[model samples]
Each structure stands twice: as structure tokens, then as C-alpha cells.
Target: MGNGVKAEIIAVGTELLLGQISNTNAQWISEKLALHGVNIFHHSVIGDNYDRLTSLFSLAQDRSDLVIVTGGLGPTDDDLTREAASEILKKPIFEDQETMRNIESYYEQNGQSMSPNNRKQARIFEGADILKNDVGMAPGMAVQKDETLWIFLPGVPREMKAIMEQSGFPYIQNTFPNQSPIFSRMLRFIGIGESQLEHELRDLISAQQNPTIAPLASNGEVAIRLTAKAESETKAKELVQATEQQIYERVGDFVYGYDEDSIEETVFKLLKEKNLSISAAESLTGGQFVERLVTLEGASSVCNGGVVCYAKSVKENLLEVPKLIISHYGTVSEACAVSMAVNVAKKLESKIGISFTGVAGPDEVEGQSAGTVYIGLYVDGESPFAKRFYINGDRDMVRTRAVKKGYELLYHHLKQKNY
Candidate 1:
């Protein structure tokens, strides 16, 4: 078993450099490799230029024990990975008969004519182990050159993930039998800024050893990823959970969900549990707040209906916000938001109502600056209230934050009511 297997990722494609597509393959591969305890020392993105690829491959071989390359394995002229690898390994590319048969079968089964250039997908480097691609045409390869191991994968994310999971994982397990894997869990929090979350966990972050805490922030949310390394998955999770408990004891109030749990998901789950139904009235956020809720499965049971009161007339006429109020407060006020929330709940006969009214703008509206947002909430038989916020960013950012904030407030309110 290798004690320390340092891996380097080289993503090849001019599209990645031109921002035509994101280089998500590197990020995904890095996370997958971390699970098996392989440390990634570097990541590089190069164009389809043969010289540049060859140079990067050679550099990776010099410093890294394992080199993983993605892209440039297609049948097109610009797919230079195979040619570059051939030059570096001093090995000729040969057609693998079985791989060729698979490619032919794929085309035949799909009722498509196979192009002559498609035969290029079956070529493999000399003396290399073939990584079967069940999901795609190009077969991946693993070769040992000098002291380093080189792995080449397809650029398509689905094919790469499938090949790595089915074939690559077993190979890694065999190569690094004694290495401990890294396990991570992310705690998702809303209504909290990244800086504040980090500050609350400052002591834990500084004194970390086995389990490490990393805080990540997006448009309207923050997440703390707790990663722990251990021999077994169970042990690693236990370490992460212990660290998570300490975090929860401190700043858990702001936490709404765990890894992969969206605020809408949490809201729906809680509403369903409480046997409640919801509706929303939105202005600057448009229908985004309700759209998020209804996207989830079985959301109809908890989601009554919604109205996008984007215009002042809609807010005054549809949601019953008085014309005088819109004239005075300009539809972006707390009074307007409260009226929308209360009227939407009454009109839809829902147990709860949420509203978003804001200025998501490049230019000021009604003399109000951009990013001025107000969220209103009304639960059945409860007094309605509104919260105002001056969010920062562009129009889309303001709208997104406004929607998320509405969900966060509702979630907190539900929790407080023990519903």
C-alpha cells in the first residue's frame, strides 16, 4: 500500500480556458480522490496544444505519483491527449479489438452509422490497463511510466464519474490499501454571513487536526464542511459528527439544513410535518419564491398558490394593498409587504403566507437604492411582520437573496412555534 499518493489533475480543452464550459471535472475528481485518501497537489488546465500538454504531463510526472487527465479523447482533430501521452510514455497507440467491438455495438444499437473517425476512440497506449467506459464511447486508460501512474478519463462528466466509480475506485483501493479516506459533511446555514460563521468557530478552526472545517459561501447561504480522515468510513463520520456537534452547540440557530438540503426542501418538509399549507406574494423577486417551493415533489400538498405582484396595481388590486399605501410607501415598504402576505394567505386559504418586495435594480426605484429588500410573513391567527434588508450585488443577486431570506425567516418562525 502506498503511504502518500500525490495526484495531479490536468484538464485539457480550449473551451475551458475560453469560459465556454466550466472545468467541473477537476473539482469532481478531486473530491472523489479525497474520499480514497489520495492527496491532489496541483491542478492544471491546458489547451489542446500538443506541446503544452506534453510539458504539463512531464511536469506532473516529475512531482506527482498519480496524474489524472481529462478531455481531448474524442474523435475530433483537436483531441491531442492520446498523441501527447504516446510521446511522453514512448509507447505507440494500438487499437484494442474488444473496445472497437464495443464502439461498433454502441453505434449499431443506437441505430446510427459509425463514422470512420470513431475508430480513433478504441486506441489504447501500449501495455496500459484499459478502464472500460460503459456510459460513453471513449475507453479510459491507466498506464505506469517511470515511477508515476497516469490515468486518462473522458471529458464528459457522466462517463468520467461512472468509469471512476466502477473501475478506478477498485484500482485505487488496491494501490493504497492502508491509506485512510477523507469523509466530509457540510452544514448548510442561512440568515448567517460567512464571516460570522467562521468567527463562531474560530477556536475550532485554529485548533483542528484530524477533522478540518472549511466555510463556503454562495449568493444567499453559507456552509461549513467538516472533513475527517480515518481508516474506515464510519470512524471518519464519527469524527466529523463530533466536530459538528460542537459547531451546533454554538451557532446552530442559523443552520437550516445539512448537505444537499436546500432551504425550499427544508421549508416543505417542515410545512408537511406541521400539516400546513403556504402561499406567497412576490414583487421584485417575481414568482421565484413560490417557484422554488413547488419544484419539489409532493409540494402541492403544502403549497397552496402564489401571486407575482410585480406592478403597483397588482399589489394594490390583487393583493388588496391599499392604493394609498403603495402611493405613500411605493410598494417596496414594510406595510406593502405585510399587506401582500396577509392578503395572499387569506385569498389562498393557506395556513401561512410569505411575501417579497424589493428593489432589484441597476437603477434606483422610487428613490430607493438597489438591493433594498423587505420580507413579510404571516401565519394563521398570528400578527404579521416584515424584515428589511439592504443586500449587496446585482439585480439577480438581490432577488435570489430575497427569496432565500423569505424561506429562512419562515423556517425560523415555524421552529419557534414548534410546528
Candidate 2:
């Protein structure tokens, strides 16, 4: 099939519905299936109820070409995947002799007698192909009924992944020999709101087709995912790259990195490249700003360390923020922030110094409202400056966003020097 294969992932478990466990199986399966050009249109989670499971199976049969169900394949009384599949397909359930032998062999090796209920794990729909579970007890099954091809795998992540890698993928490839492959790329952007980014590319998004564009926002950053399907990987990449260039032509300034690139990582790379060392004095953000920097490898070369001056006395004594500035402008003032940045850099003898001082709270400080933030930056050759920002969120959101904005500012400053 060319991109015509429609797939749905059904995660069967009460724990998933109850939020005791996440439905990561569907996510993993969807990502794998996309590599084979299978379009995953829907995801569903059903509790261990037979009627509801059968109903979902019936719906999958009508709408999807492939239905992959994970969980409920155990030997316990609550295990109902095989029973529901049999009921939906009007087929009889029979135990596979090969799987039964493997189960008995496993228990024999462990010096324990196999329980009668354990036979339930070997049961499969009539005429179904068994996908051996090399890592677990219950064998996965693949059976076709009418137009729908159903694959049942274990819910345990390790076992599910093993079975898919060993047998499930091979089975799908052999069945659908002419399948196209789907390739996708994520272009990450910072300093741009999701709404504004969408508005800027409204026309490109509206007229999207193959190599579809989708914008996703997460943790103060936005990403554009471009997915393309082609018979060859090269062709798919070409389609994705062409679309990415169009996006860059519009809002290139905001785009920082590509897939899996974090702002901190980008900043660290830039610092290393410029042979620059930096120090920080954190007030409202605590040590989070420096904490992020030191996590990266080779950070010792660029990071000179930091001082967390949450208390006003510490800012005065340790960072030596001028008492006159704090008395006149308060601890959260731009003047105090500048002193903190300049003093920390001088004390640490670094080329650059950054400071975060703000009121992150449900209450105001020194007449400044909550979410009021000031970021101070000092480069050896450039003048020290502090920018005031009014963010919108709770205390935690404000702190997190403030840290991100600091990275954005640093990124722009370092990037500008390249020209």
C-alpha cells in the first residue's frame, strides 16, 4: 500500500484508563508503524471489560485496515483480548501446541509445576499465526478477518517491543510488500508564541498536502513537524527539506535548532565555540540557570560556576551587590540585577555574567507584581544591561519561562556576534 494503510492502536488495560499507568505502548507502536508508512489515525484505551473491548474491536474492523491491540494477553481471569477477538471474529479459540510446550519448558527449567490457568496464555484464534514471545509467557497473535488485519501483543513494554522487533514487523512487511515509508523532521523554534508562528505561516499550513505540516507547542517552545511519504527515503527527505526551507524563509529568526535540540544545549555549543567562560548569580531562579549549563559535557570549559542569592543579605555579602543599589532599587530591581551580574563576573573572572532576579510568586514584592522578572547580561567588551519582563503563569511557570527567556537572550547575543 502506498500511504493508504489506516491503523489504530488500542491499549487494553484498566490501569491505563485509571491513570495508574501511561499508554506508552500506543505511542511506541505508532512511531514504529509510521516508519512503514502506516497512517495511525486514532488511539484508544479500553478497560478490562469484554463487552466494551468487543465493541471497540467491531469499530476497528469497520474503520481501520489494521488493528493493533496491546494488553489483556495474560493468563489471569481478567485477561480478555483473546476471548474478545474470538467473539468479534466468530472464530473458536484453540491453544497452540508449540507455545504450550514453550510454557511448560520454561516452568520445568525453573523447577516449578505449571498451573492449569497458564494454558490460557497459549490460546489463540483459529487459523491465526502465532508470534512467539521470546521474552515473556504470552505469545502475540496475528489474525485477519474480512478487510481488517488484527495484531495482538503483550502490554509489558520490554516483551511488546521484543515481539514487535522479532516477528510483528516482519509479518507486516511480508503482508504489505509495496508499502511506502513515512519520514518526518522536527524544526524547533524559540522566542515565538505558537499562535504568532501559526499566523505567520497560515497559508502554508492551510494548503498542506503530502509532507504535511503540524505545529506543536511544549514547555515555552514550538516545533513544526513535517511528515512525508515516499517509496524511497531520499525522496521523502527531499520533500521534507523543501518544506523546511519555506518555513525558514518566513520565521527563520525564531528557529533555533532541529529535532531533539534543547535551548541549553544550543547555548552550551555556542559558548564552547566562542571560547567564552560565564558565571551566574541567581535570585528568583535559584541555581537552575547554572544547573542547566553544568549538566552538559565540557561545560567546565565555559561555566565558571554561580552564586544563588535568594536572600538579600547573601546578594550583599556573597555576590557583593552594592547595598546602596538594593536600598534604592530593592532586590528585584534592574539596578540590583545589574550589580549582581557585574559583581559575579568580576569575582569569578569570567568573560560573561548573567543574572536572574525576579518576583516569582502569588504575592507582589516591592510593589512589583508576581511574574515580574529582570535578566541581566554582561559581556567583557559590551555594556552590562538588564531587561525587565512580565510573564504570565504561576510561580513555577514564571521561573521556568524566565530561565527559557534567559537562554533565548543568550542565544541571540552569541548568534549576533557571528556576523
The per-prediction tally of clashing pairs is: 0, 0
Q: Model 1's lDDT to the true fold?
A: 0.89
Instruction: Work out the TM-score per prediction.
Output: 0.94, 0.84
Summed over model 1, clashes come to 0
lDDT of 2: 0.91
**In candidate 1, what are the lDDT values of residues 1-419, reduced to their tens digit?**
22488888999999999999999999998887876778888999999999998888878879988888999999999999999989988889999999999999999999999999999999999999999999999989998888788889999999999999999878767755788777888899988899988888899999998898889999889998888988788999999999999999999899888878999999898999999999999888889988998889999999998998888788877788988888888888898889889999999999898999888989888888999999999999889999999999988889988888888898888988865
- Deviation from native of the Cα of residue 271 in model 1, angstroms: 1.0
Q: How good is model 1 by TM-score? A: 0.94
| TM-score of model 2 (CA atoms) | 0.84
- Model 2 poorest ten-residue lDDT run: 1-10
Best-fitting candidate, scored by TM-score: 1
